[model samples]
Target chain A: MIKANKIEKTYSKTAILTPVLNDITLSIQKGEYVAIMGTSGSGKSTLMYILGCLDKPTKGELELDGVDVYGMDDDALSALRNKKIGFVFQQFFLLERTTALDNVLLPLIYANKYPDDALQRGRKVLAQVGLEDRVEYLANELSGGQQQRVAIARALINDPDVIFADEPTGNLDSQSTAEILDILGHLHQEGRTIIIVTHDRTVANHAQRILELKDGRIAEIKNP
Target chain B: MTRTIRIARESVRMMGRNKFRVFIMMLGIAVGVASLTLMMCVSKGAYERVMDTVNRQGPDLLQIRPGTDIQTGLPSGSREVVSLIEEDVSAILQHVGNIRAAAPVKDRKEIEVIYEDKFTLTRIFGVIPVWAQIRDFGPREGEFISEEDISFAARMCLIGQTVKKNLFGDLEPIGRTIRINNVPFTIKGELQWKGISSAGRDRDNRIVIPITTYTRRLFRDMHLTQIVITVEDTKKLNKTIKDVRTVLRDQHKITSGEPDDFAMRTPQDLIDLAYGTSRSLINLLTGIAAVSLLVAGIVIMNVMLASIAARKSEIGIRRAVGARKNDILKQFLIEGLIVSLFGGLMGMFLGMGGSVILSSLDVTASKITPLAIAAAILTCGLIAVVFGIFPAKKAANQNPIDTLKV
Candidate 1:
């Protein structure tokens, strides 16, 4: 459901030429679980950002669901991000002062669909993530595992086709990390396409396909 | 929910969190509005007080005196000496459609009024009986001289409260005789107290007698010094004055180009002029107060900008959660509005209280009007919005990624 051809991203200034992503080409079909694995400074995050429509590529053609995302304006790109993709961050990035229910309802605010059932849907997602009793608790009051569960609940609130998990288990304990991996596997089995960006081999092993990044280019793609 | 309302509510909540800052902000605006209200009340009250005094004297009473030339600042042309005689007064009353009543007046020098041993120097006024009604002075005891007394030239007089106090010394002066300039005159009545006039003349320290008796016995044809006329209605006073002036000019036979021998005045004219001056003074004072309110609003804007900077991460989170740029702008604008609203309310109350206290202490205070309150609130709202724009724009323009980075 997503495609990129010769995507290039660069930063300006200074005599030395520096590129964050150079001539990267990739594509992923619907319901495919993919992992982009890279160490620091390997352009994995930049690629993830481009795919998420959060930033524009310096030079490229990007198509999502037959729409040229690269040609979309800022508002259209934001709308695409809201409707087509859900993001889960390493820090769980839930609003600190807001309750778990409200955190999950955030994406629905932009979607403007099923607004009357937003609270009910958020509650259902929280229950699915095993956070039924912590729906009203603030994000800061939750443990790393519980916070990540809330993030996952938020990702599922809009029932988006693709979910982006960037270093999702980076800050969690091993047991919490395993639980999050199991949830990702379940989501994948449910026919939701999932992309996880991480450096951990165990995390990458949960994906159906793994793409490794070296410097600013994709080194290899391995079918797990 | 509507974006502005949501932002206003959030702004209120934020203000609630920072109690001390809100308190300081309100203090500045309250002081400005309160002082402005107080000054307006005092000036209005003083103007009304003066106007009331003028009205009580007579509605169409004109004091034609020697005019001081603007170029030289001196009495012009030998004082003109165009006395208001009984014939002139009668002519105005007969010819002027709106002239309800008119009377001639003359006064004697300070004379000794004695009842047995109690005595005092008092002004003895030579006035026609109709003058009493025109001047708003009614008898507190018995009655003023009648037309019969005027025709018969009776030796009777109406004494003022001060004269009664000095001559009778707690005893009723009616039906008793008082010596005025060594002439024994029966005290027909005691005049009611009428307070002081705008010209600072005492209205309760004079004795009144029929003009016929004064002209025949006290001062003969001293050119009937003044004419006091009461118009039928206050609204038609200008027309009455014009008619009276025309009659006077016809009687005196002064040609169109010649300076006339009379002047006309109305209580409404004096009242309006005094009110205008008072209103201008109030506007000036209010303008100064509004400047202070603007300064206070600016202070609020500066403080809110600093707060926006400090809460950058909070803003980023809100924005990431679907808050539009307009929402952020509304939040800060609402904050300013909240501060100004509370401040304006408090100031209004403070102003009212101040006016009441001042009036109680015998200071003149203006009557409070709904228009004034509405104006005060509107001014405060405008101040909030005008000063709030800069801070709100600054907060709205912050980039979510950059703000969230730290």
Candidate 2:
């Protein structure tokens, strides 16, 4: 479950304020599959970031699973993200020169639980992403598609309640993109809330609901 | 606790990745610690060496020599005149309660010694029979001069290594006759091989004869060249010195406020003087070594700053994965500690090796103490922590969102 009330974000430079998000309010029930779709500068990624508790909003109330995340300190916010939300980035954001298994173990480092069993869980998650054979390969040794799979495995390692994937297919071939989309669809079916931020209409089609953002505000919500 | 280990393991892996850069940084610290250790080794070793020589002779021995004017401390102009006599020595030995033995000595430099065709010029010293035990110069072969030799003014003497080498030329000089200043004397014994003194003087280049023989047959004067006083108790040396001065002053007929015509030096005095000189030398060397550590610290800081700049993305990724600011700080700090600690250990070994080589070469009597090694390591660790803070703080405070944008 996630909620936002009139969320606003702005960047200030040399006494000039530029708003990135304005008066956007939304909510999603538990285990719902949703997509935030927009072109560049449409604030769709910003909204997703705020909802994932990675960045704070200038004006709004944000709640994740009945907890007021905005009121928590940096440590508490990080703990919430480690437990309740996982992120997949456009660049994959996997640590270079690190093994796939170790990358998958990243979230567990901050999860503050099951330290001894983290390796076993990381191996299981890598296997779930069909990367068990490639778990020992470094990020630099993997294909773009395989790297994205490793990032996905890392996201799944914590078993978070929600997943935020930003342009997950932006740098992939059509075949790899389809593979990633199928994984997302399967995860959604498993009753985990999914929010994908992307500009591709085809990518948005995999979700049950699509919220189109324009000019830093939510312009329309369509069920497909 | 396991998490902490994970973080340390990651840091070690990171350092491994940057092998060349890390080695250069560690080398800088290593040189600094090495210099620190070497300096301490040299000074401490030299100090121990001097004390060893002093203790070997006798800790309570005092040597008195005539100098200057009887009433003034100022030196009487050239062509020196001796004022101390056998009477002054006997007075100190009688009236000075703590004096165990006071042997009056008479010595002359450039005395020609000849054994058949072999000949050389050396110092000839005359002392009472008891002086042999007091100076720790008792003959290692044959025998020292006897009381019978002193009273009879017999032509018997003990030769040192240098004099033996020049006059005897590998021949057994004991029981052999040698001519000193054209006067024939039988060699009764040979002295031990005493090394050079701290003042850089040869210690085994003289021959000893009885004082009675020296006064009657050579100089024919009662005035003594020096007085070697051995105290009954070493702890009471200061009191003995004061009493000796009182007796000497009364014998020489000097009044209050008048400077004595003689100077006195004890084994303790030599030790204090040696320590004072070595301390200054050590301080100067230590100061120079400390500067090296400071320079290494600066170099480490620069390297760490560049590393922080290069790892921005890595920092962002770790932050995204739940690494707190303190975690990042600790990682870098631990990285610094690892480098410095290893460098310090390597430096200690290098320093110890260097000191051994130096001691062998006779450049310095150098040795490394355990405390010095521990201290050198601790200093390097502290230096790392001190210099690492700035870069570690910068790494910890970076904006993860901005870093990710890169």
Candidate 3:
């Protein structure tokens, strides 16, 4: 479902060039649940970003479902992300004043062809995440776990092929983390590819495969 | 179309994020539009009032006054000018092509007249019978001074409304005798109410007598203060004016290139003279409209910039969710437009309501025209597009990664 070949990422500030990711290569099959584990400054998040099509690699080939992901233009890449990738960040990034249902419907708004039953689909997704009762509650009014669920519902509204959760449980309580991980696991079981980024070994153990990164390169891969 | 509606809905949602920010943005446009509408209404009303005043003097009417060729200024406190005379009036009346009627006038300002041991100071004008029709002032009751009165130099007169009130005081004015400079003249008519003139002087505080009697018995001169002429076709007034000037110069024996000792005016010239005195007030109104709109534009732009600065992360979130740069641009631009449109509508009502209130209070003449309404509305849209661009650009050009970092 995904392939990366010799991926490299470098950030330049004036004359100084800082390498973040160096000669990284990896692949994950369809329906696989993978976790990228690293400590601070391990470049695990950078690798996830490149793989998720949110950031372009400095020098690399990335293929998702046989398409050259990095070869597309900015608008095409945005459309690709809208159609193929779902993201759950630690911040939630939901519009604070909007309702949970509205938050879930956001990505669908940017869809090239909006579905006529968009509102119905949005409600269904919110129901799937057990947020049906809180559909009318504003994002700020919801608890941390509830807000993350709303974010997940947003990520799932477009029915994307891959879900990227970057430290998704970092801001949540333990119970909320278990609930969110269970939802991610359920999404993977439903034949969607899930790539999770975390420094917690226990979180990595929940995945079918774990890729460990050290100093900008993949240090080890543990198969399920 | 659905996408457009979705984005428009998003823009509205963006506006509702901060009520204070939206209000701040609206204030300038509202105030600007209100002042602009008011200025236009005042200007339109002032113009209409000027035309009414000028039309009262008669659009086809022309005046040749004794002077050294100045176009404006009332020839008051006169009898010094000997250049314009009865013979010039006769020549112009006979020779001018479009002349419908003509009358010679001689006036003395602030003259005291007596009635039955009571006296009031008023202006005295001596004119022929045709002056009534040519100048549009005639008897409201009784008969005007006739040609027999002029030819026979009869001691006959017409008393104006103010004169009747002051000198006669509810008594029958017609057939009564009043003394001008101690000379007696029988009242032939009671003239209509003339009201105050554009110069703010009481127009009805004057009396009229036969020009023959004026020259023969009153001011004792063949010299005329002015000659009033009405034309058959007002559209040919310019050609008629040229003809009158030529006839007057010929009668006065003035050569070409030598300035005639007379001034001439049409209703247009009178309107210009009236507006000249009020030009400063008009300019001040215009300046208010301009400055307020400019301030409004600046305030709107700055407030939008500040609002964008506060909503930077919101823009980043929109971008991360797959909104293109153009989507961000269209969103913010529509937000500005919506706010400005609301403000403009509010101001339109305010300005029109203000004009009605002002007119009702007699503060100033004011008229509301559709053009003013259209201008106010279209200007709001234009302001949004003009002032909304830079801030929207700044929002669209922001780096999403940096904004979403935390």
TM-score: model 2 vs. ground truth: 0.85
lDDT of 2 by residue, B42-90 (tens): 8889789778868866788887778743332122322265778988877
lDDT of all predictions, in order shown? 0.76, 0.84, 0.86
| Model 2 steric clash pairs | none
Q: Clashing residue pairs in candidate 1, if any?
A: B41-B366
Model 2 score (lDDT):
0.84
Cα DockQ of the candidate 1 complex: 0.19
What is the iRMSD in Å for candidate 3? Answer: 1.4
Per-residue lDDT of candidate 1, residues B1-406 (tens digit): 5445545666776676677878877877777777666666666676666667565655566543223222221112342454556678778767878767777877754667777887788777787787777777878889988998899888899988877766777787799987777777898898998766454556678988887787776656566556677777768766766777788889888789887665544565556544554566566667877777777777777777877887786665455444566767787778878888898889878887877887787644466666557767887788778877888888877765546553
CA shift of B132, model 3, Å: 2.1
- Which numbered prediction scores highest in DockQ against the true structure? 3
Best by TM-score: 3
Off by over 4 Å in 3: A5-25, A37-47, A56-60, A113-120, A199-202, A211-220, B68-73, B91-99, B231-260, B276-278
Model 1 chain A poorest ten-residue lDDT run: A106-115
Which residue pairs overlap in candidate 3's backbone?
Answer: none
